[model samples]
Target: MEPEKLRKRINELAAKKKKEGLSETEEVERAALRAEFLANFRQAFRSQVEMMQVFDKAGKEVTPEKVREIQRKKGLRDD
Candidate 1:
């Protein structure tokens, strides 16, 4: 999902939890989930920044096809 949508959902969940009065264990779970979400966001942003750096150095467009090919050669698949 998009970051904005994910953030909205997280906020809604947090509000619901606050309304319900979360236990310590539930709070820990929420913290873990939030940390994981932020980590994923950071990784995605880092990959984008790296791609931009590559383009700046190479002075060429980084096509989606090239990205897909790299992922394919690395044995990574959506399935």
Candidate 2:
């Protein structure tokens, strides 16, 4: 689902919960929507992290080897 719509439904369910509460089906739907939201958030964050470069005060790179390896595998690094 689109992120905006997903959030809208989640917020609606939360407000309903605070007011009158949800049925069992709505509870399940809310859980699934939240999980999907978190997964999408994590994926976007991981991509941002992967494309980053880290440096030290002396201009030498101090990026972790694991991150470098991922960059290389994705063709982001030539060295």
Instruction: State which candidate has the highest lDDT.
Output: 2
TM-score of 2: 0.95
lDDT string for model 1 (1-79, tens) is: 5667667767866997979877787677678668878998899985674343234456775446666555566565342
Q: What are the runs in model 2 whose C-alpha is more than 4 Å off? A: none
Best by TM-score: 2
lDDT of model 2 at residue 19? 100
lDDT of 2 by residue, 1-79 (tens): 9999999999999999999999999999999999999999999999999999999999999988999999999999998
Off by over 4 Å in 1: 1-12, 53-79
Candidate 2 lowest-lDDT run of ten: 60-69
lDDT of 1 at 40: 86
Which ten-residue region of model 1 has the weakest summed lDDT? Answer: 49-58
Candidate 1, residue 3: how far the Cα is off, in Å = 8.7
